[model samples]
Target: MKKLLIILIACVLGSNIGFGQSKTKLKEVIVRPGGQKVVLGTKREKADYGHGGAPNNPKYQTAYFIPAKGASGLIDRVGIYIFQKHSFLEFLKPSNPVYLYLYKADAKDLPGELLVPEPLVIKPKKNTHWYWVDISEYSIALPNDGLFAAVSWPKATKEDNGPYVGMTNECDSCPFYLYHFPSEPRWLKVDERMKKSVEKGNKEKLNQNLMVRLEVSLKK
Candidate 1:
């Protein structure tokens, strides 16, 4: 009877261990690159933007630009791209986050007439940073003064050490690509309120050839 009891106990332990292993394997599958999808926020929300460098490309040279919709003369163009990974967030994540940088072009920097182009629309996911670009803070009502190209990364704060490249399950195992778009609610500048806001903190006024750089690092 004692031998039979021991055999039963051993079987129970073996089953529990097997179950734990199975659960662990399942989690691994779920976390594997591209296990989930990253969704963008509604049209009413602002999209994030970022820049960093990638190792795969040589010359260490890279360029990424998202055209503005109604920029015309006010904003010639908005641009951002990775100079280098700069951090681990460059990889190892469920979704790519946004990186924002600002550049104010000086009078001498202005070249010629700016052409307006259609902007790309993207959605944002919770706890995920997505790249975003805007031609004007508000274009529907006040389009002239509101002109200025800007790129921003949503979610990832300055505390993050490196820039991370987000991954989604939809195109699992494929290179990540980000979409661009304008800011919603159509920002309108009233009595230099927008200008003052841009001058505050590190934000500067609009320039003829503005350029911004951003990097993102993932947390744990």
Candidate 2:
């Protein structure tokens, strides 16, 4: 498991370092909100596969379709299970920043209208485990169908950098999307990307369910 994890994050995040040993369980992360908080995602260890930037797309994005799963009316937090790909003196260097975004799920289960008015900056760490962010201020509402929690890279990101989000094979499946900067539609399903790869005769396929998740209140 350890050896495999090392390889997985390295390839996905475009780094060359060990991801660290996997813990048995993800502890319930606490937030400032008074009501109950629900952590949603694969609920299992991160899968071997991962997702990130694409060629020619300097500022790309990837999102996970998260179901309300009985969440409260308003969202308060967003969490991501991430693993660091650099831990040496090089780790002393700051991680490239990314943006956090939320969108109501569309009819086709894609990200619809942007939820947050302004994109929040996320300075990820060099570690392994869940990193939770306070979005209680956003007061994002849970759509009836579901929502999409996404992260986007900077234009400086040519292909990709370290500190990547994870995926999981636990639930049999989960819906996720990727966005090529400045595209007309702006979002594409992971399977759609895979199909294009095959058409181009590339052996690669993007079967990923990002670990991105959001928390909502249990109270009215």
**Number of the top-ranking candidate, with TM-score as the measure:** 2
TM-score of each: 0.22, 0.72
Report the number of the highest-lDDT candidate. 2
Superposing all C-alpha atoms, what RMSD in Å does each candidate have to the true structure?
25.1, 7.3
In model 2, state the lDDT of residue 134. 81
Clashes, model 1: 46
Q: After superposition, which runs of candidate 1 have C-alpha atoms over 4 Å from their true positions?
A: 1-78, 86-90, 94-96, 99-146, 158-220
lDDT for each residue of candidate 1 in 58-129, tens digit (9 for 90 to 100): 111111222223222222123232222333553455433433322222253211122233322222332323
Across residues 15-71, which tens digit of lDDT does each residue of candidate 2 receive?
Answer: 212233354365444455455656665566654444334434445677777776665
Task: Report the CA-based lDDT of candidate 2 relative to the real structure.
Answer: 0.59
